[model samples]
Target: MRIGCRQKMKSIIKSFNQQGFAILHGVLASACIEAVKRECEKLVDELATKLLALGRISDTYDDEPFEMRLIRLYENHPSETPTIFRRELHLRGFFELFAHPRLLTIAQAILGPEIRLYPNYSVRPKLPENRRTEVLWHQDAGYTSAEADILRMVNVWLPLVPVNVENGCMEFVPGSHRGGVVPHEKDEYYLRIHDDHIQPVVAQAVTIEINPGDVVIFSNLLFHRGLPNRSDHVRWSVDFRYQDATQPTLRNTQGHLLCSKKHPSNVVRDAVHWAELEFQ
Candidate 1:
């Protein structure tokens, strides 16, 4: 690696180690960002078509901006906007983003050469005033079963549009991951940390704002939450996790390998290969 690139990686790793999260600004190329945006647009279009067929929407809002079209499509039927897309992740654009070279390099730095993309990846669209889209304050590990404490993983969050306090950007309590898994309770929409545990660090939370090509890498044990979408437009973001390939996932399903040295044959070869693989 070049001297500058090496230095950058070192800085990211250091931040992650200390704060349990790191922000890589504008790491993705413009072309890659646009490709993902186009794919998201396609998804919105498909949803609009279905809604029209069901007589839920009269117009598809084709002329609306990419960020606003989804908002308009589901304005009348808020329940229809998809908050997570995991099944059809084999779509070409998603594969490109998931296997992004720079992202993989960062993962390798923390996870070593062998890395597997966790199967719980998701594409979230936080729409305005949508209760289902609002995520509660909790550690990512809390969502998993009891063995979650033993799992080793890093989460990558990439936005398709500018994210800030107004558009439901994520907020994190620095160094919270050091405490390990705290207590969590199942809320209506998702899991949430106990009030006593979150109250102490709640005051120290920091809002994470980034551009489309940037990425936020955080530990699975970090205390974090997605703010409400106070803005008029949609906040689109994709989140996925990477785990050390050698570790046990504690589950029957294993995600695809993104890079490997010992077992090179296990790596996902291309987009077509990813599409062929089952959701598991």
Candidate 2:
């Protein structure tokens, strides 16, 4: 059953705790989505301009739709195409999405009221038939560090376009978080759960198909993977995490705090304030 934002949030919370994940529909507005898309277009435009100056491409592909713009820009240079973006996320347009009240509330329930935007946030553009974009089954905790396994946090995934099995939507094994961190082995480009461990639950995996306004919140220990993008266009998405602020980030750069009762003055004040800060 699809869970809408209007439905009782308690049930969504319940589902997250019981099943290790929950898909919340209609969690964002059209304007909010558009803002992020515009920012994405701007980023692509910069890349196109740089490529143009380098005489890599003759056409900027400015008229192309958001879904195809990046694909068209890098059609001749797949090797140079970027699959992940991180440092450029400090733009003002992303502030609303990061500090969204509804999303923070859910994070607060899973974690505590003091929420810190985890340092691992990123925007991934899954390109068609690109091995670099294909992610294998692995728990995020295993990728971070041993201490990250104990970090109280929730992962958030949102799409900029419609997603399905064809365009590389996420797939998760329900209730997989209860098993703790499973053994993960390195793959060609990503990490895959040990065959012996994941084989028993492969049949339980479910495809996560959602739209721009929907969000998938899951545990860091949840078994999940992104399918190959077989479509003609790109599967654009952003994923981030919210962790309890009281704990050490175990990294050189500490993420910004979204909400905190102990040190309310430190929370990101507003969109402008968010833009002023770096990814640290």
Candidate 3:
């Protein structure tokens, strides 16, 4: 079974290299997923409480289901609601997911033993028909400044609920990363690849339909976009990058080291420690 598992990961790594992305089905434990969900619920509770005090929300929507609560909360006042979570993610559950050994192994295969959890980690709740949540077609590299070529990164994404064309699932152009970073023009909400650069291969894009506990890893340069969420519930997902620790993050904040042979002491110690540390 160990050999079989290793072989499967080998295949996934190969696919990731050639196709610019690879999906690993059922790679996460149900307990791990539940932990993150609990954390998200806690965050929502906190947000609801604050909003109630500030007169931003008439109702907390606490009785709503996890997938529906946030969407319902913001339905009346979308502008006041937050769509993305960053620093607030330093919870025990999120730490367990981010520092998971299996994920770190995959990161190590691609980025060597030294790895850092990149500073761009985010948890997004895509509300139904919200323009603020619809991501445009662009390479992850395109978002970075001059470091687009230097930052070695692989992005990992998974959905809390099953995702498809209806709920803002992502689509990727196969082998698009090979072309490197393409020119991206500024859109109102996000940067989009210039039409001249993406039109030819855009038709060949594959929709990434995935379920909870399924993880998809893609290159930083992969051409990708998220469809609008037409479903009634919020489509929640977390994305984080693992970087080769040897290179400079090129930002003011240095991300936490997840693994390292030389700087073993600097590695994030445990879930409790992760929760204690603030986003840097």
Q: Per-residue lDDT for 14-105 in model 2, tens only?
A: 89999999998998998888888888889999999999999999999989998898899999999888998899999889999999988998
RMSD of each: 1.3, 2.5, 1.2
Q: Please give the clash total of every predicted structure, in order.
A: 0, 0, 0
Instruction: Please provide TM-scores, in order, for all candidate models, with all chains considered together.
Output: 0.96, 0.96, 0.97
Model 1 earns a TM-score of: 0.96
The regions of model 3 sitting more than 4 angstroms off are none
lDDT of 3 by residue, 69-123 (tens): 9877777788766789999999999988899888889989988999999998988
Clashing pairs in 3: none
Candidate 3, 144: how far from true, in Å? 1.0
Candidate 2: regions farther than 4 A off: 1-7
RMSD of 3: 1.2
